[model samples]
Target: SRAINADTGVNKQLTQMILKWRRPGQELLVGKPEYKSVIEASLGIPCRHDELVMEVMWGMKRFMPSLVRREKSELPKEDLLPVSQGLQMLLSSYGFDVKPEMVNDQIVATASVLFDCDAAEKKQYRDFHALGRHLKNVSGIEYENWDLLKLATAFKIITSFLQ
Candidate 1:
């Protein structure tokens, strides 16, 4: 709150944004337009929209190395075809360094950090208010719509992997 001056906050926020763990190769999937722009700025170079995706990806790797350091072999098996196919396609398409076996581990760990089961209902999904509370309690950031969107993505991924 105190330090996030409007000036440097964009860069600082972008830096913090990309530092989190993404499932195996997702850190490289700049499917969103915003990712490329921030990454390009971080690299201090422009990236091509089509051909140079890998180069920008490399820039991201150099910018944040700790993201892919952890790997786990045992993962929960929901084995839903769409989920399995989706992950497999993503892995094959992106050539993510994360091995297939470790993907679920990364997904679950990332989920643990990003989403919270409702404190009252426990099994029910948290509403936006609960999400805001949980996120604030977890990360101390005032949870915004963007954070809610991030949590939704994590929830969908985690739910797909759960039995």
Candidate 2:
């Protein structure tokens, strides 16, 4: 996948607005008429609902996470290494390239900044998030709330058949 230019100016502003105004279970769609009207008025152009959905999806794909590096704690590296490595491989395979390290029992990248890639790479992260949401919907287990060990364990269980 090739790099996509960052959203700037009006597009960036519109993206932020769309994200801020979005509601749960309506991730891609603009459910409220008032929000739609506001978006159209902000752009000073006539836009359809589907077009707004596309814009929201586009913004989601380019959404970047703020990686705040944690100081190394007394947690055992032996316990953290395998989980970190597993996550690193899993994320790298999807083009996110998060070289996650264990910090205070959580898996975070050693680098303070994780998103140095373009929209294509960033989209992979969005896909991963969607996968998590789907898993929650199906199994009633919130993957987003899982810790590093739990995430790695679930990842291993889910991907074991591929091995």
Scored against the true structure, residue 136 in model 1 reaches a CA lDDT of: 80
Q: For residues 11-114, could you state the per-residue lDDT of candidate 1 as single tens digits?
A: 55545655554343343455335555656556343434543454444334332434555643322243211133334444555455555446544653443343
TM-score of 1: 0.18
The window of 10 residues in a row where model 1 has the poorest summed lDDT is: 74-83
The digit string of per-residue lDDT tens for model 2 on 21-77 reads 665445334434554565455544343466445445433322222222343333345
Most TM-score-accurate candidate: 2
Model 1 misplaced stretches (Cα beyond 4 Å):
1-31, 38-44, 48-67, 70-163
Clashes (N, CA, C under 3 Å) per candidate: 0, 0
